[model samples]
Target: MSGQLVRSLLIALATALVAVPLGYFVAPWLGWGVFCLGLGLQLLFHFRNFARLDRWSRHPVVDASLEGEGEWDGVFGRLYRHEKELRQQIAQREQEIAMLIAAGQALTDGVVLLDLEHHILFCNRTAEAQLGLKIEVDRGQSIVNLVRQPEFARYLSDNDFSRPLSLRPERYRERVYAIHVIPYAGSRRLMQIKDVTQEDRLDQTRRDFVANVSHELRTPLTVLAGFLETLQEIELDTEERQRYLQMMSDQAGRMQSIVQDLLTLSSIESAPPPEDEVVDMSRLLDKLRRDAEALSGGRHTVELEIDGKADLLGAEPELVSAFGNLVTNAIRYTPPGGRVRILWNRTPLGAEFAVEDTGPGIDAKHIPRLTERFYRVDRGRSRDSGGTGLGLAIVKHSLGRHQAQLDIRSEVGKGSRFAARFPLHRVIAQG
Candidate 1:
């Protein structure tokens, strides 16, 4: 502005210098008239330039065609360059904001921003779903008012954020979330919400597993201890002493079986999937039939049916353990004179190894949890039948390694059928 004014003043001074010299030689007052006319013309030119600047300012867009004339050209050029730079900066900022939003959406956790008054500022899609909020509707609204959770309101009011808050919203009763609020940017706060349902479930499972192990071990250990103490302190007859020893050995064997099953389950869980060795279904079925008959000890009728020429593509030992568990479970559960049938069959999708028994069937509710470690339909009956309870759990893990699925269909008092179906990819045709 100052440069433009000085240049204008210099032009006016030169006009006055030329007018005074030319008009003084013509007349006395003519010099003043000439100077006045020249100054008026200069003012008119300045006014036109100002008018052009005003029109551009109303809708300022950087256009080369809008270049100014004479002294104003430098001013317009600078304005165009400055406007272009400003636009570039704005575009860059917009890109950064877009990337940040994308990253937030991709995250597993939810994010929310709030003002000092706890009014909602911004939130990601995850936050909306987790908190049951709609950003468009909830924005600028008080978070406590919208959430309406007394605990959340209290958490904010207390101003204590050293630990995260665990919440189980009524809307999502089964899910658990951990929310942490951090103060940032002077007065604003950022709330990070993470769904911890799986973590909480895993923690509970670990606790239950430990408790079950302790309980299972304690029963057998107590029996062994009692028997040992009686043998050491009392004078028993030969027959009585032999019976006590036999009972002790039976309890020892039960503990050993439990330990071995636990080890097998742990190995299956920790180790990678075994090599896909061709498992001979014929030989495997023959072995399973013999093991079932021996386990049944003629109490139940054991049968084997091979309906398919398809062998499994999996580690032989894993397949054996998986198939053997089902057969053993069937024989154990079947009553005396009941039938236990082991079958290798082909389905449209692939192949299946199934065990059917004429035992009392499982309840529908218990079917889903049947594969859980130490889960039993009847604890007393299972223990009496010498079941480790980890049999089904081990079977599940082994089948999973072979890319197979276990299906259980049962009805009360009608018996049960347990089938392990292998995907087509895991089935090998025997030539």
Candidate 2:
């Protein structure tokens, strides 16, 4: 038995023994009455202790010092210690839950937790943005209803979570997401979402790059191969033979140009940023004018205008190649009587090296992609003009190395202007 119970029994036994003997010594009725009085007093004492216990129970505090008197102290002390341990365990569990939530929120990928019925239980901030969900509002809503994609609905129904689902959400049509569902904690599911728009675009671009390169190189190789077979198999006059040789040479040169341009672009992109080297803007402008005039071959009127005396700070060779491409493009596109003006001017933002041409201008839609490799507004016309289609792309990368930007402003039938604007840090004012 407990110590409190044993003590109470002994106290009761002692009370009965003392009361009965004393009462019997005086009178028999008195002995019985004394026993009854002792019993009643004992009952009253027990009731008073019970009332204190009840009060403690109504507003119990887990404190070691908060206890009862006599035998009840042990009972109150044990209860307080047990409650303290229980509270500590509860706080520990709460802390673990908080840490788990924090870790989920720190992830870049979206995460959603769902019950067996696919009801949304928890979703992190990334999930909220990617899937357009409000945790507070959508907490018990079904995932199928919230996503509302037919394919996604089908994927869930099929229970084939073996492969991740790749889809563009209707709300975010431009972005692509890869979704994976893992069945965990019995029947509940964990949904993970990763944004793969850039990866997808890069993959597509790689495919297009390979296809375009093959197409461009194949045409010239085929022409050269056909003519070589002709020269070997057929007998021809000296004049015809010379003409055929010239055509073969032209094809060879075209292939060489394309290869050279590709190599230049690859080098520019792969190489580290060029060391800061002073470039003479005045001299560069003069060289551009000469190169443009030579490339023009009296076809267009080439003019040079220098309104800025600021020298640029970058690799001169890269600057030459970039600025030269702009001039060459202007001269090649402008008509025989038209004007091609190469201007080096100071703007509010920075120094601008612009090539303004009275050529057939570009459409607005085509201007944005003009700097992409092998991108041409008109493929036939570009090929006829003997362009490798990588000039603007080269210009773009080269300018990027110098902290510059290529700005193309064009309107159909109104001619075009291509400008390379250098940052203020790159411009050195001549004294």
Task: State model 2's lDDT.
Answer: 0.89
Q: What is the lDDT of residue 423 in candidate 2?
A: 88
Model 2 has a clash total of 0
Clashes in model 1: which pairs? none
Over 74-156, each residue of candidate 2 has an lDDT whose tens digit, in order, gives 76778788889988999999999999999999999999999988899999999999999999999999989999999999988
Off by over 4 Å in 2: 28-66
Q: How many clashing residue pairs appear in each of the predictions shown?
A: 0, 0
Per-residue lDDT tens digits for candidate 1, residues 1-431, read 78878878898898789778877787757878878888898889888878988998899887877777777888888888998898899999999999988998888899999998999999999999988899999999999987778888899999899999999887888999999999999999999999999999999999999999999999999999999999999999999999999999999999999999999888889988789788888888999999999988889988888886888788898888888889988988889999999988887899989999999999999999999888888999999999988999999999998888999999999999999999998888887
Candidate 1 yields a Cα-based lDDT of 0.90
| TM-score of each model, in listed order | 0.96, 0.90
Q: What RMSD does each model have against the real structure? A: 1.7, 2.6
Worst 10-residue lDDT window for candidate 2 reads 60-69
Cand. 1 TM to true fold: 0.96
